[model samples]
Target: METLPKEQLLNSLEHLVDGHLQQAIRHFQNMTAHDLLQPAYNGGWSIAQCLDHLNSYGHYYLPKIQQGIAKNIHLPPKDTFKSSWLGAYFIKMMDPETGKKKYKAFKGHIPAPDLDAYAVVAEFIQQQENLLIYLKEARSTDLNAIRIPISIARFITLKLGDVFQFVIAHNERHIRQAMRNVTDINKRILH
Candidate 1:
């Protein structure tokens, strides 16, 4: 098995986490004031709402990870995956090693929460910042050795390393959603 070198894992995760954050920030930076508030779709979430929803996963679930870490107990994991064409595409896009770890998508699309766009963007940034800090301060050995609190049915024993990967990937998943919101809004404005 090709295990990730300590340096590579650290570098990749740092870059991955920060890069997606930058992507999300830059996406909104160019938006006009009107573009920022556009609904994600007719009768659907606004671009802002979409960010909040996408970010809420981290905000909601990361604390579980902290609780698990603090208590040294396993958390009942919630899958934040979707089953749309985009979800399927990202699954296929993952590196084979990562493909082995993530939870499978549910049969239907996961719904984005309805909320103000500013709230969504703010929460997303907060979650990303928190995760980066947690990961940055923890040791590679701790990450590679900690027993993750995962589900019983999944039959996968997750290491801190695995958990680290999941957090990073999960962040990326939402960043993609945030990006979609931006794209959708821009398309609407141009049309």
Candidate 2:
């Protein structure tokens, strides 16, 4: 994997997070509870489920990342980040564009069937807000030096930069899934 400028990587991740914020507010927030609960044409997860699933990950990762950032705050931020082979693999797997492969959600991350739509969306928005703050704080620390533990594989920890990339890409994948559910629902209504 090629080395990336730390600023560039942060900017890219921030842009993705901003898009997610817009999507949640403009699209998901406006959706009706029933619509959010409706499954996609492929019988996949509903919009609320998608957000809830992401929220689960956010709950697990945000604190860990925060701790990592805090521990490494004394270290001056580096100019570039070299992706670990494992980190690169996880990021590629999470990317929606490159990773089309489906995997079952960890039992802990699987969202419950009956969820409060408004509550789920609200939590997702808050998580995005937290992510923005973390990204900014991370600028003061060495992204490649700090390590964050993964929720799925606790034994393996990835570089802070890699975690950010992986988590945001994962969020993008599910956000697209949620949007597709909405679009498919609209098509059905039109028909």
Candidate 3:
């Protein structure tokens, strides 16, 4: 189990969330429907589809984290957090930079091709704002003691800190993909 100061972990996660929120506002704000739905150069998911996929995961995770926090609010905050082996594995796999392997998303998490670009982007931005609030609330709770069930397998659970890391890493991974799609659309227009 990897151990780190609790504040350090929360701060890093907040930084990632802030970056995502900023990127969404900057890159996705004024995009036309055609640009958002435009597929990547490699024929992968479009920018809107990418956010939609993330929104699906957010719908499952954010509430789980919130509930875990509320349930454990009585416990005194711990100074440090230890990542469970399983949680570490999941976070590593979800990280965009270190995890290069691709796996198919679960069917329920897949985004439809006909999504309204504005609504998807708007939802993603709202989710990010909600995540920031959760992160702040988490500071008063015991990060290591609270457990949250994974969305794919509710029977399994991870430390709250680990869940935060995994969820944010997953968001970062797809947000990067969305940005790549934006680049592809720009290049197509230039040529």
Candidate 4:
């Protein structure tokens, strides 16, 4: 497959950040102040905590990506997605036409973030601002030069730009999940 254009990736990064903010803002807008603090489901994070996790992680990734860029370092293999034991069988099961599915259902919710919606949104937006600054200030060569890792059946490496493109697809994947969660949660409570 062809590598994604740099301009496209940067533009998309901007969109994902903005989209995250908008979705969270809109969700909260419809909710009462108290409902925002209620756990999302029986035990899952409330909507506010979800944003807090995203808020924490937005800046959290910077250290890794920055280290990779500055030292020409590649992160440990843990960052990658691994193919399963079914291997080629599952490969055949997937449609080669559509890109990989964005998110898989998982068993558990994480520890809730220790923040309110106001703090979380403020922090999340600032982290995005920092990301934009970093992206703009870094030379194209830096983005093109850094080696980042991913996996299929095994480890593979790509430039920083490619990694972010992959991450953009990943972002859309989770956004879909978040949207679904919001819808499902609202349905359960309101209906």
Clash count for each candidate, listed in order shown: 4, 0, 0, 0
Residue lDDT tens for model 4, 1-191: 33445555567667775776576567754665466556656455666665554444454455656666657534332222222233323333332235454333222323254545566556655655666665554433446556555333225555565555444444344445456557767787787
Estimate, for each residue in 105-162, the C-alpha lDDT of model 2 and write its tens digit.
Answer: 9989999878999999999999999999999998888998999988978999999999
**lDDT on C-alpha atoms for all candidate structures:** 0.55, 0.94, 0.92, 0.52
Q: Residue 32 deviation, candidate 3, in Å?
A: 0.4
TM-score for candidate 3: 0.98
State in Å the error of residue 100, model 3: 0.7
For model 3, residues 28-139, the per-residue Cα lDDT tens digits are 9789998888888898999999999999999999999888988889999998999989999999999988899997999799998888999999999999999999999999
lDDT tens per residue, model 1, 2-54: 34455566567778878866776777645654565665564555566545544
What order do you get sorting by lDDT, best first? 2, 3, 1, 4
Ranking under TM-score, best-scoring first? 3, 2, 1, 4
**Per-model root-mean-square deviation over C-alphas:** 8.1, 0.9, 0.8, 7.7
Overlapping backbone residue pairs in candidate 3 total 0
Cα lDDT, model 2, residue 18: 93
Model number with the top lDDT: 2
Question: Model 3 RMSD to the real structure?
Answer: 0.8
**TM per prediction:** 0.63, 0.97, 0.98, 0.57
**Where in model 1 is the C-alpha error above 4 Å?**
29-46, 64-113, 151-157
